[model samples]
Structure formats: C-alpha cells, structure tokens
Target: MMRYMMSLLAALMLWALPAIAQNSGPLRIEITEGVIEPMPYAVPDFVGESATATEMGRNLSRVIASDLSGTGLFREIPAQAHISRITSFESPVQYADWRAVKAQALITGAVSVDGSGRLVVKFRIYDVFAGQELGNGLQFVGTQDGWRRIAHKVADQVYARITGEGGYFDSRVVYVAESGPKDQRAKRLAIMDYDGANVQYLTDSSSLVLAPRFSPSGDRVLYTSYETGFPRIYVLDVASVGRRVLPTMDGTMSFAPRFAPDGRTVVYSLTQGGNTDLYRMDIGSGASTRLTNAPSIETAPSYSPDGRQIVFESDRSGTPQLYIMAAGGGEARRISFGQGRYGTPVWSPRGDLIAFTKQSKGRFHIGVMRTDGSEERLLTASFLDEGPTWAPNGRVIMFTRETQGAQGQARLYSVDISGRNLKQVQTNGGASDPSWGPLQN
Candidate 1:
C-alpha cells in the first residue's frame, strides 16, 4: 500500500513539473501561434579593463546583439540612438535614458582578462519600463579563442530572462557543403556555428555525403556516404573527425540514418532484395533489428524527444506520406491527410510539432504540422526547398534552398516557425542538408 501511494505521488509531481518550470513574471513575453511584434532592445558596447579586453568586449557586444536581433523576436536599437553610455560594470542602468529611446529591455556586459589569459564575461538584463533587473546577473569564464561562444552564452541568458523560454544561440549545425555546378556538384560533410560561422570540414569533397544527423549529445554525427560504390551509413566523432561504416548484411544498403533519443541506437532505411524498409541498429554491438517489413519504402525516421515513438515517411498508400509508430516498431498510424505528398519528416525537439517537406501542384514547401496532422501550415515555398531542421528551441527551422536555373546553387536558409524572418544563412560556399545540434553545455 505504501509503494502504491508513493508511485501515485511521483506521477503527480511529474505532471506538475512543466507548469512549475514556466516563468510567471511581469517581464515575460508570451509566444502564441499568431504573429508577434518584435521586442525593442538595446545593447551598448561592454566595458573592458584593458586594450585586449576592450577589443573582446566590443566584438562580444556586437555578436550578442546580432544573435538576439536575428531571431526576429527582438529588435536592436542602434548604439548611436542610446542616450546613456555604459562605462563601468558596477554602475546602475539609466532606465530613463533607455525609455527615452523606447527600448523595452536593455543588456549590459563587461569583459576582463586574468593573469592566465582566461577571458571573464559578465552580463545583466534589465526591464527598462519596470525599472528593475529581470534576473540575477551572471558571469562566464573561457579562453580568448572561445569569445564568440561566450557572447552567445550571454545573449542566451538575456533572451531567457525576457522571454521565459530556453535560448538556442549556443549551438552548432552540421551540413553538407556543396560546390561547382548544379549537375556536377561536389558534396562534403561540414560543421559550423548556428549562424553559419566557424566552418570546419569533416570530410573532403572527394566523396558524396548526405543527410548528416547529430547525435543526441552533439559529440557524433551519422550520415550516408557513397564512397564504397553504394550508399552506407557512417558515424563520425565531431571532436576527432574519425569515422567508421556501420556493418550490414553482405548485399544490403542503408541510408537516411538518425539517432534515437537514447543516442546508443540508430534508425535508418535499409534496402535488400529490391525492398526498402526501416531498421534499427545497436551501435555498441553492431546488431540490427528490422523495424518494418512492409513492401513499401519507409525512410527518414526521427525519434520523439522521449524516445517512446518514431515518426517517418512511408509510401505504403501509393503516395509518400507521414506515419508514426512505437519505438520498438509494431503497429503504425498514418498522420497526414493533405493535398500534397509529404516526406523527410523530422520530429521537433519540443515534441509539439513535426516538420516535413511537402510537394504540391508544381511547387515544393517546408511545413510543420501537429502530431495528429492538424494545424498544418506551410512555412516556405521555393524551387527546391527540403530537409527542414528545427533549432534547439524549436522556434526556428533551417533548410536547403536551391534556385531555378542551370547555374543554380544550393544555399542554407532559416525561417521562423510563423513563416517570418526568412533569410539566407551565409556560408563560404554552397550548403545544404543542415542538421542542427543541441545547445552547448
């Protein structure tokens, strides 16, 4: 009897945790499915104690402002419009000066370098209209080489304090970098910061690679390669760039690999005997399990945040559509009933929506729908827009967009879930098949 009571109590606590975790403060920004006006904010250059620190401070402030304003949720007021200049970290904010410029929120920061050359960053967020600090000030310590990362951390905290949601600035994206003409393009695996900075190539353009998926912990990547004359799955460590092909049956081919939420297993499409189906693999033992035995092709499996269920694209009903099934794969249910053919479905990290690429009439689109296939909304339409990947916070999506022409090239683009702030992601060369990783620790 005591054990039963304890179990019930624990279940109740788990149900109540999400409500308790939400912020119910005066400075919170409530986000709904409708259009929202961007919040106006200001970020002055941070104060620094020395010459090198000053340079770091200026760049850090610029990057932080860019990170916040790029979201389309917050608008940055130019430094020239500010009436007050922050000269010290210990000084109090001039709320009246900020309010004069109609800045609803203000961010102030400072940078310092220690004797060991470690960079110290400190920041605070203020509710200018309320005339109070939104949250407690925080500090981060890192090396000079990681100044941009430190800037992202500061911006994330400021965003969280004002918006009452998790921030996604401190994250990275793994993608396939492309070059040359459209027909004879060269593809390679590359990783970069979320805003298309700090690009590092994992594999050269000597071989073709596609559909790079980040591990749950962001330490590894799974992708399909055609180096062995046929498509196969390979896992690469993000830190060392070391890679190894996952073993399969002597004649079978595997592709479209995605990691299960547990990170120890992978779900992918396998082809054998002219039949394509989904399969799960235990990476530790290299053992394989057939998840689907249907005659139709099943591919692009993505695990839910809890790992209990999987969402994938299938062609069982004569046309490509979206389906959901148990993680262990027994029975499945169709979730999409729309005018268009859907494929490449990816489950959002928040688990509230599933993003997919759709084809209708004569155009391609990137769209999102609820788990039950309701509230389906198309976010983009392009000549060739596919492979939608959600940001860490699930508020934005990045995908590949290719222009229409013989000389067309593929580039990366991002858009808000509401279909606002559509812009191109700057890369040194053509980029596509972006996989957004989790935020850094």
Candidate 2:
C-alpha cells in the first residue's frame, strides 16, 4: 500500500510540473497566414541614473517603443494598462505583473551620463511568461546628441532575437531632394536616417542631380550630376561632402551608376553616338570595360549580391524590358515578359528577387520577380510609380509614387513584399529616387 501511494504521488507531481511550466513558459510566435494578432509588449520609462539623464531616459524609452511597434509584428500595451512599474533596471522583473496585463514581452532600460559627457544606455528584454531574459542584456555608449541612434540599436537587437531575421533600423537613405514646382524643380542630393531624422544636404541646388546610389559600405554616394553642362557621374563622400566626377570622354554622357558588391567596381551606362551601352569601371584606376555592345539602351545596371550576374533594363527587344547577363558581359536572357514595359531593375540584397518599375495600359506599378523570370508579383500600381529600392532585409520595398495630372507630385512610398503596409515617407519637400543603404555595423 505504501509503494502504491508513492507511485501515485510521483505521477501527480510529473503532471503538475508540466502544467505549471505551460502557464509560465516562453511564447514561440510563428508568423503565417491572415489576420494574426501582434504580440503584446510593455516598455516602461527607462530609469534615469543621474539628474542629467531624466529627460533622455524618457525619450529613449519612447523611441525604442516606437521602433518596435512600427514594424506591425509587435504591439505596445498602453502605459495606462500596465499593472506594474519598473523602478530599477537591475531589479528582478515582476513576471506576474506583466502577465496580469497580458503582455508577452517586457522591455526595461536605464540611462546615464558619464563624466566624459558621453551617454550610456543599457537595456534588456524579457519573455514575461517564461520569467527569463530573452538572451543577453546590451549597452551602448555614444554622444548625448546621438541618443536616438542608441535607442534604434537596442530595438534592433530585440527584433532580431524574436523574429530570427536581421534588423534594418540602424540604416540611412540617400535620395534626390527637390524644391520648387515640377516644371523647373531644383534638385540636390540629400541623405538622412531611415526614420527621416538627421536630414543633411550633400550638394547645392546650383545643378541638377539624379539617381543617387549608395556604396555597398554606405560611406560614399554615386549620383548623376549635370554640373558640367551634361549628365555625368559623380562620387560623393558622405563624411566630407566632397565629390568628384568619374572619368568619361569629353562628348560622352555617362549615367545610371551602381556599385558592385565588391565596392570598388562600378557598372554604369555610357551614351555615345546615340547608343547607350553598359560599362564597368574600376574606381581606383579609372579603367573602363564595356559590358554590353548592343544598340539597345542598357542602363540602370545592378549587380547580384554575389557579384556573379547583372540585371538591367534594356530596349534591345524593341520594348523596354529587363534582362540578365554575366557580370563580365556576355549573352543576355530576357526575364520580363509581362504586359508592361519594365525598367530600373534593382537586385535585392538577398538575391531572391529583383524589384522593378512597370508601365502598362497607362498605369504604373512597382513589382518583384524571381531570378529566373518566374513568380512575378506586382505590389503597387498608381499613376507614375517608379524606382523601386529594397530594404536591407528584402522584405520591404520603397519607391517613387507620382500623383496624376498637372499636380503630379513625386513622393517616397514604402510597402511590404506582400503588397501591404503602403506608407509615404515624409520629407521637407518633394523627394524621389530613394535609395536605401545597408544596416549600420
């Protein structure tokens, strides 16, 4: 009878332990088909360790929340609904308090200013139900003026940990900044953070600039500047704001430049004798190599992520279409055969898709397709949408959407690869040809 009772107690204990674990266990979220609710998260104001850090602590917490919630994968639980307050970053998280508010994730942070006037921000993310930290806590040190960047960095780590994908929050974008009316618009080159925060102009409006492309490292920019009476390619240093024109013949116009993954080689188009052909140039030696000899207008050359192939727009088949060829210049294969004229083919960083601008039936679209010209999908269609740029993750695309009629204004718009979350990027004035840079290291 004693042995039987012991056996029953052991069985009951085993079942009880699993039941307890189930209620306070890590929540694994798998994103899939339709209408899935966002994971609820809570972020209390960061603890300010010193008098100077009071405002910064509050601001940093707000920015971090905004960054994570903006992705649509995580939802912020309103502070009013939070049942518990975090008074110290080093204190043990009260999982029961978070669970009371039905929060799956909790974020805690502390901010302080060191003796050198540099700001230090440290944070940790917790799996509330699991009653454990997600991974490891992180700390960032930077100037007080760059607190926003530190906040973005913390959000990036948390996002990558939960989603199992790289983060794009710590990146920048270079674009054509325009002012005045569309007819006589004055354009210059400008760059800003991915969130449109630190706006800085790289060039003056004394000349027209177009199609600014970032180097693979994001430290340099390549753009077409008509500073010398015609369209010419110029390379600009992001740090120094200094620029120099790429070598070209006196009468030949070179435009549509793109950086290879190697960062030293450039492939662009040169128009001579009314024939536009693709050419590759080495930045150091100014050595030019012709990649395409066809009579077609081959421009907007983009290299594959592996630097093995190139995808560009060409009119070789009588209509503007997309074609892929060896990076070293060889026989080409047409990849676009839909009911539209395609141009501005940008190879995604992941090399899984190529984004392009399509025009058909008096309408324009921003679309993506596989490498072998299969599984074509259009994400957006409007009056004059053009120039599709990919996010670092390749899960989102940004493009230019122009309004219709005489009031046709150009603006930067972004959408997910699934054809959802269409959003307009706010700038000081008109903006176009937005190029996204890689994530900051």
Candidate 3:
C-alpha cells in the first residue's frame, strides 16, 4: 500500500511541474527578418440586435480594427477586398472567401442592447486557413455610456489571443501636460487612456509637476512637485486625484521616486546640503532606510518584478551610469560601459532586461540591455530622447522626445523592444514624463 501511494504522488508531481513551466514561457511573437510582419485578417461590421446597437456595432468594429492594425503586427484587409460579407455573427464563416483575399484570420461579432439598457458584445476569432474557431466565443456586458471601454475590452481579447502577450489596450498613462512657452512651460499632472483619448487633468498648472511614476497596483502615482517651493515627492491616488506630500525634513529635496513591487515602500533620492543619496521609505510607517551612503549622486531607482533587486542610475563612477544592487541595498555593480552617460534605467517587467536613456556624443537615445549590460541596443536617437517607460507586457516602451532649438517642444513616443514600430503618441498638446499604468482588470 505504501509503495502504491508513493508512485501516485510522484506521478502527480511530474504533471504539476510541466504546467508551472508553461505559465512562464516566452512571449508569443513570430519574429522574421528581425521583426514579424503584421498578420492579415478581416473584421466585418458586427450585426446589431437593436436600433441603438447599430452605431455601436459599426464603431466597435472600427475601434478593434484600428487597435490591432496600429500595432504594426496585424494588417486589416479592406472591406472592398473581402470576397464574402458577414451578415450574421452566428453564421458559419466562408473560409474560402477570406482565403481568396489572402486573409489569414477572421473576426465576427454582434452587439445588442439588453432590457437593462446595457451594451452586450459577443465575438469570435477564427484561423481562416485552418477553417475553425481559435477559441470559444465570449461576451462582454457594460453600461451604454461605457461603449468605448467595452470596445477596448473586445480589442484586448483579440490581441491577447493572437499574440501570447497580454493586451495593453485597456490601460492608462499619467504624464506632465505642458502648455505655454518653453521657458515658462506650464506643467500639470494629467491622465489619459492608453490611446491618448479621454484626457483628464489631475492637478492645476499653478505648480510644476514632473516624473510621474505609477505604483505596481496602478491605483497610486508618485511625482515630484514644486508647489512647496522645493522639489518634493507626492503620492496621488489615480482614481480620486487626492494627493499628499511624502514626509521630509527642512532644507532638503527629494525626487526620482519609484514604488517597490510590493507597493508599501518607495525608493528615491534625497539631497541634503549639496550631496545626494538613495533612500527607501515605508509608505505606511514613514520609516526610512538608506540604500546608498555614497557622496556621489544616486537616483532613479526601479525595482525588479520579484522585489529582490533594483536597477538605478548613479554618478559615483564620475559619469552617470546604470547599476544594480540587492533590494535591501549594499555594494552596487556597474552595468553600463558605453561611450557616454546613461540615466533613468528602468527594469523591464520580465526582469530579463533594463531600459534606459543614454547620452552619447551630441545625441540622446532610448535603449535597452541585458541585466548584465550585454547586447546593448539603442532604439531611438534624437537631439533629446529620455525617460523610457515600458508597456505592461515589457515588449514596448514609451518615452519623452524633445525637439531642438528655440521653438523646441516635447512629445511622447513608443517603440517596440525589437527596435521597430516607432510611433508618436497623440496628445492634446505638448507632453512629457509619461508613466504607463498596468492593464485594467
């Protein structure tokens, strides 16, 4: 009896090990010639069950198409090119019609207005070549006023199923919105949808705000505000927009604040007298722990995903460079040995690479490297490109890019980790210092 029980236990352990390993598998992207070509697909206008649902059906289809096509990983075959039309969502797909147009995938959906006046969307995706549905059909229900959000959900689902990486469509970005002249720039904290829609101002332009960083949970944002006469760290709840300054002593300044993965602590720079050092503080108890006692400047600390290590920028080596150290703080090893200075090193969500801003010669660039600083590759170069924030999947990065000269301006841009698909993030006006929040639940 004992031998039989032991054999059963060993079999169960073997099965569980493979399941755990599958969960951490590499992201799904079929790379070819450095980057994968956009997959060809078709998404016909959805069928509407009610009069009120007609417009939503059309608009939702457009939104989903735009979201997928904009990534440069998927191409949408125009309606005119489609050989067969989808009049009913439940009808079987004519795979041969899609194949005639060289479409590899097809999407069909339906929209309806429930008795409760809520919007309901149902959709399915198919591998046209294989002539079968990729997964079970799904539905999303939400208020009519939230149609756009519901559209985002539909897009997110399609993106996730096609790419193995989680979708970032249902996310937000917090940044400093600038207006007025470059010299008298009016910087204010602002939040907007990941696509740059639904802009909302979080703070007035009365004081300057900079370097907004989102907490791991995406509910709180940490930024350095100059409202109190000197640079001070302030935490604001994204949902409520309520804020309070972090505790600090007189005649000192704190900046470059970042939240730990656990969300209970923060790491930032404290400048006392003329010297700057790195310190960690517990948000709840207000207790402080000094991470670096160096006389040189040490700032811009970012935590690893597991909360075991931190990557930050330091000038201890005489020039600004990237460094990594134990999360509790100790001897730091320099990770950058490039031609110029590097700063604002942010650890990727996958914990396998570090993204940073490098200043080489007269040009500024946004780049990434392995955690050990090998295989460094610059993604973008301009007169001034700095402050890179990674996407939720860590496959893309958003950063601030400023033009040169008297009429210079700052804008937000994104680039894939493979150094392709450089895109300008549309905004109301000039913007900078963007912090990307996680995908919404």
Worst 10 residues of 1 by lDDT: 4-13
Judged by TM-score, which candidate is best? Answer: 1
Would you give me the overall lDDT of model 1?
A: 0.88
lDDT, residue 71, model 1: 81
| Best lDDT among the predictions, by candidate number | 1
Residues 214-316, candidate 1, lDDT per residue (tens digit)?
A: 9989999999999998999999999999999999987888999999989999999999999999999999999999999999999999999999999999999
Which segments of model 1 are wrong by more than 4 Å?
A: 1-25, 32-35
* Residue 421 of model 3, lDDT score: 77
Please identify model 3 stretches exceeding 4 Å from their true place. Answer: 1-35
Deviation from truth (RMSD, Å), model 1: 7.1
Which should have the higher TM-score, number 1 or number 3? 1
Model 2 alpha-carbon miss at residue 334, Å: 1.1
* Comparison by lDDT, 1 against 3, better one: 1
Candidate 2 lDDT: 0.85
Clashes of each: 0, 0, 1
Q: On residues 256-287, what C-alpha lDDT tens digit does candidate 2 reach at each position?
A: 99999999999999999999999999999999
Per-prediction TM-score to the true structure, in the order listed: 0.94, 0.92, 0.92
- Candidate 3 residue 274 Cα shift, in angstroms, is 1.0
